[model samples]
Target: MDCASRKFYHKHEFDCRDFLEKYCADKPDMEFAEDALQFPTMSFHYVFSSGFVKGDVLIDISMGPLIHHLYSACDIFKDIIILKLNEGCNMETSRWANTRTGAFEWRHTSAYVSKLEGKSAQIQDKEMKLKEAISHIICCDFENENITHPVVLPLADCITSIWILDAISKDEDEYMKNLEKVSKLLRPGGHLILIAALNTTFFMTGGERIYILKHDANFVINALSKVGFVIEYYAVQMRRNDSTLIDYEGVMFFTFRKTK
Candidate 1:
């Protein structure tokens, strides 16, 4: 599909459950599991464990209701605030956070994270801690001056945005604008952890072709510099599965600090 013909992610209703099944499920045979699940899980574990980003409040701006990456952050950050672009994501995330019936099962992912910490037996405990740490899940508009308008939030110590910019931005300028907006949520010298799919044009989710901004590592570095963020650490996980669902070369993880 052409760029103009492709579906804009923020304009349509997202099938959160379908997205979880396609990418976040624990099935070993799932084609994009390595790129979508294991990479972020491992990266977040390492970032948090290394004490590279210290903070009490963590603001998460992600594409959908994916929470597997936050398991590690919840152990370190006392207050976890999630900002979603749509109410569907909010409800879906709330279902899991509240442990309501029909919520998508995440025990398998949690078990993997626990094993990484060498405390596999504390899976349930980890889940409970995450649930409690998540103080709020608010719907937001990145274009607005106050992304979380009508409910002001204190500047966050750390912010983690995973794959949202790639899926939502229509071009490089919009991506930079979105990045700048997200950076405003962090205090000076605070950290921003970004995980992006490299050189991706689009992704297939819920039988729909969603547009993803195509950009390389250099472009991202330049954008961050323009937004006053300095990269502290960088890592990339090369694509392990030749999945036709997404046209991504690899996934890049960056730990950046706001310089001003």
Candidate 2:
């Protein structure tokens, strides 16, 4: 596929519902579930349970309106703010948050987290806590100086960005610049839990091929270092499924602390 022919997430109209159905749905037959839903949810649960991330406020800048990654976070953070690149995503998330009709079901994901926490019976309670923890869902512009513009948000104690940088960035320079912009959202000494898809060029979603910056772990480590973030933990999970939805070799998870 021609790279130029691919759709850019920032320029395209993302179908949030379609995205959920394709990657995040609870169907046992979904090919992308292991990578899209399980890997992130499990990694997050472990990160929070192991005492690696502790914060009163967490800001999530992830692709789509996915909340599976935030299940464990709700237990650790008092406030959770989600920043999306478009209003559609924000509205989709609000639907789930408010328990509106036709919202994508996340109980399976939450149940997985609960099982990891050894409280499988408290799945409902876990979901309730996460809903209550989400304080705001605001639209943001990564290219703007003030990502959230007009609404100055409190510096977060930790920020979680999952598969967002690669999806929106057109090249390495833009990726680095966006990384710098995201770093400013954290206060000094705050942690950033970042997850990236390794060497993925494009992902098929909503019946369209979306572009992803094809990069490796070394580039990410160097970028984090240059942005004054000290990497404390890094792990890579090799791709488990042989799905053509996305050609990611593996998923890389990093825990970094801001030094300045």
Candidate 3:
């Protein structure tokens, strides 16, 4: 099955506002290290806020229209290019970036992240920065592994993808292969921020079951190592027992830097 044809983003309500409300509104009982959403945001904030791990360009591969992770990137990088699998995700993202009314509002998410970073009053300010930093929303094919082929894009200084491989891959082999292929987009010594669901095979959205490639921490660690990345930070948040939402044991966030 063509991964793009699955149209998960089209059916799912994956707006940033919905994501924050559903997964991040309430503080987790566990420490920051054990909270999936919080951990990723905090880790990103800590790293990028330090003025380290920054570059002129950051490319987001298979981003699926989610800008939650871009909060920190916008502050650290001068330009952001978002590459997605299909047009639907691109359209939705463009709507939000261009501030079209009725588009999913993400000011709340910006405000929350500002609060996390001790800049509670800079919510609107950060939103404006995010809007300015995002320079492009283009389509790319992960399976092809030639994201900017025929017209190569400037090598990215950092790449961030969240649950993109699992959501699109048919199996572990495909997932690993795609990971290596996508990692090529980064320049040597560039950073990679990855967030994935642990041991999850499926998620529900719009009354439909969306299948994903099941994977665990060991698999991901080995996969990245094999593809010339060194892990810098790793964390996971155990999933709460919820029959109503997705069934996954946990969410894992990993920060890696390309070595070769």
Candidate 4:
């Protein structure tokens, strides 16, 4: 029986957001480390994404399991820059995001990893191995309604994000505007890397259907090109399986450079 096809398995009792929310509620403690698997969702993301290394900078918006896994896997850069939306701040209300250590435990899998992977300085150990340090974004409000030029990101040499742009904006102009704002903190020749999902739809979860937009890789690529990003490296389907996924959307990964 094919799970991807209907009639093969149990009806989905939950929607994506419901699962996302519930994952936070049920397992508050384990959400951080398990998220590392997100990188391999596509074929190329794992191969190309050079996780935190010395002298590098990054910003993660809509902090998810991926970032936590990353913090564990590689020492990204000298100055680790983080960016999160309004959702990132509220730890108590929001499930796994603990501002205290900048780790997200919202997903049960992630929460589970947070605790079991004890005696961590795993982050520091990886950083020591990679030779780097972490730096906080100065503004602390990447979600501000107030937009300005040169969006300030301290110690930023480059930026990296995973599936955040389409997740945040349904309105095209607003989405483009936000990316432009994010660009201000980056210096010329800086890179912007992403692990993204392709065309998708409203998924039903805990009890509600969440409206998610499908993004055409070309559309995103065109948008980035318009915004001073020179496409450097792009890999589709970064070597991970969704064999268990029931007719879900596909994933795309990219690496771009700031030419302006």
Best to worst by TM-score, what's the order?
A: 1, 2, 3, 4
Weakest ten-residue segment in model 3 by summed lDDT: 27-36
TM-score of each: 0.97, 0.97, 0.85, 0.60
lDDT of 2 by residue, 1-260 (tens): 56577798877978888888888888868887777778888888888888867879999999999888999999899999999998888999999999999888999998998998999999999999999999999999987988999889999999999889999888899988999989999999999998999989988878888899999989999999998999988888889888888899999988899999
* Per-residue accuracy of model 4 over 1-260 as CA lDDT, tens digit each: 12233210012222333344433334434231122243332222243344422235655443332344334323345455455443323232223222335334334333333334453334334323322343343223434643222454453466666655655555577668768866776777777766666674443444444444456779788989898987777756422334322123565667778888
Model 3 residue 185 lDDT score: 86
lDDT for each of the candidates? Answer: 0.89, 0.89, 0.74, 0.47
Q: What is the lDDT of residue 128 in candidate 4?
A: 39
Alpha-carbon runs more than 4 Å astray in model 1: 1-4
Error of 4 at 182 (Å): 1.7
Question: Could you tell me the TM-score of candidate 3?
Answer: 0.85
lDDT digits (tens) for residues 1-260 of candidate 1: 65667787777767778988888887868887777887899999999999878989999999889899999999889999999999999999999999999999999889989999999999999999999999999999876878898888989999998889888888888888878788888999999998998899888778888888999888888999998989998999989988788899999998999999
| Model 4 misplaced regions, further than 4 Å | 1-38, 41-54, 63-66, 72-76, 87-124, 127-132, 137-151, 203-206, 238-248
TM-score of 4: 0.60
Model 3 misplacement above 4 A: 1-37, 241-243
